[model samples]
Target: MPVSKRWTVEVLIGEDHGNTSAVARLDTNDGTHLVGAGQARLNPADDDIPAIGDELAAARALSDLGHRLLLTAAADVAAVAEQPVHLTW
Candidate 1:
């Protein structure tokens, strides 16, 4: 049997007080949802670059989302196998 499912991710950003923040939302067809957020700030001495902040915050949020998904999967596997599992990543 073959099964196909789709997942969607949305990233929202905000800027205020010389800081940029982003949130990434993950929606899975299996009814699992996850949210992650990250923030970046401009140093007083560093050049102000909105794009840099956007990229850093977005990447951090996405990375957090990925880690969470992996942890969930690991837990599911442990439940089925009837064994305690520890994830290190």
Candidate 2:
């Protein structure tokens, strides 16, 4: 069967006291949800750049989400194959 589905990810970022954090939420459309988080800390000696921090945090969060998705897929494959499975990027 040929099928197509749309998945969306929402990223939220916050900064407090020079610490920036981001969260990425994934909606799989199958009632399964996944969340990934990342953080960035500004150095006192360095210039404060909110955009840079947000970029780093968001990138890390998305990376984390991708890894988690891989793990979930691996587990599902293992369940159907009746064996332990390891997925590689």
Candidate 3:
């Protein structure tokens, strides 16, 4: 059987006092409810550059979100195996 589902992700970006910040929120539910929040910031030495800031912020936010998701997965696996998970890759 083939199964599929949809997850929603929202990324918000903003700049304040020479600091560019971004936050990514992901919502997933598969008989289990889980929400993840990822945040990132960039302090540019030069003037305001929207393109560069966006790229940096978005990349960082995604990286953070990925880390959180991996952590959750590891915890789940450890719970089922009754042992801690140590991923090497």
Candidate 4:
């Protein structure tokens, strides 16, 4: 039998004082919730580009979320295997 599952991630972004920030959140069916945050700062000598900032912040947030998920999976695997586990992307 094949088992199927669906997961979703929501990203929220905000900009303030030439700084951009983002948060990525994941909610799993097993009632597991994970969150990751990221930030980007605009240099005074550079032009203000809102889109770039948004992209950077969102990308970082997603990266952070991915790292967390990897760690969680490693822990779960270690628990089942009765040994320490290291997972990599």
Instruction: Write down the RMSD of candidate 2 (Cα, Å).
Output: 2.1
Indicate whether candidate 1 or candidate 2 has the larger lDDT: 2
Candidate 2 residue lDDT tens string, 64-88: 9999999999999999999999999
Q: What does candidate 2 score on TM?
A: 0.93
- Candidate 1 deviates by what RMSD? 2.3
The segments of candidate 1 whose C-alpha lies over 4 angstroms from its true place after superposition are 1-3
Ordered from best to worst TM-score, the candidate numbers read 2, 4, 1, 3
Q: What lDDT does the true structure give each of the candidates? A: 0.90, 0.93, 0.69, 0.94
Q: What is the lDDT, from 0 to 100, of the residue 28 in candidate 3?
A: 68
Model 3, TM vs. native: 0.75
lDDT of 1 by residue, 1-89 (tens): 67698789999999886799999999998899998888899999998989999999999899898899889988998999899888788
Question: Of the candidates shown, which would achieve the greatest TM-score relative to the real structure?
Answer: 2
Q: Which pairs clash in the backbone of model 1?
A: none
TM per prediction: 0.89, 0.93, 0.75, 0.92
Candidate 4 ranges with C-alpha deviation above 4 Å: 1-3
Off by over 4 Å in 2: 1-3
Query: What is the alpha-carbon lDDT for the whole of candidate 4?
Result: 0.94
Q: lDDT by residue for model 4 over 1-77, one digit each (tens)?
A: 77687678999999998999999999988888999999999999999999999999999999999999999999999
lDDT value for candidate 3?
0.69
